[model samples]
Target: MTISTEQVQTAGRLWQEHRQAPFPDSLRRAEFGGTDVWVLDLYTAGCVLAWLDNDGILDAENGRILQSCIEDLARVIPEVNDPAGAQYCQQLHQLAVLISKNLASTK
Candidate 1:
């Protein structure tokens, strides 16, 4: 499924607000889609969120990698369609948008 343009634009706005918040020094090694990766924290939440920004599999300019991040999060996050999972969805959406905007600026 494709992410709507609204999702990207809304996420872009949300990203601007939290762009400066530091990711804590605390981190751990984890696996994502069979690849070994370092993540911000042990919890799946942190790991999934970090995956959006760091995974090299995505091509930022084309937006496919950002799309992949969103798809991956949907699979990894439990009950993503449920009310409690809304926050995870929101974070994923924002990160995807941030990635998109950053890539666009470089072009």
Candidate 2:
């Protein structure tokens, strides 16, 4: 799926808005609307990271954040038990894998 320029801008806004907030304390038991919030957040963040990287806007700090997002998703994947949670986890994993490959190629 293509991320529009507006979506990339929104991702940048989201990153700046939340970068300094506390790491999600709720990750250990986070859920909402029958889905894992951490997974959802990571999916969005991962997309933003990829978009930023593609647009030549990703800095080292942002790269670290992206890596952290991937790690966070990996850490929580085993905890997800529901079908919806599993789907989100799978999507996140695929995003992370693709992003990692893309980043590697750009290096």
Q: How accurate is candidate 1 locally (lDDT)?
A: 0.41
Minimal lDDT window, size 10, model 2: 98-107
- For each candidate in turn, give its C-alpha RMSD to the true structure in angstroms: 9.0, 8.5
Clashing pairs in 2: none
lDDT by residue for model 2 over 83-105, one digit each (tens)? 56555555655554444444422
Candidate 1 on 64-99: residue-level lDDT in tens? 545555565554444333443345345645565455
TM-scores for all candidates: the values are 0.36, 0.51
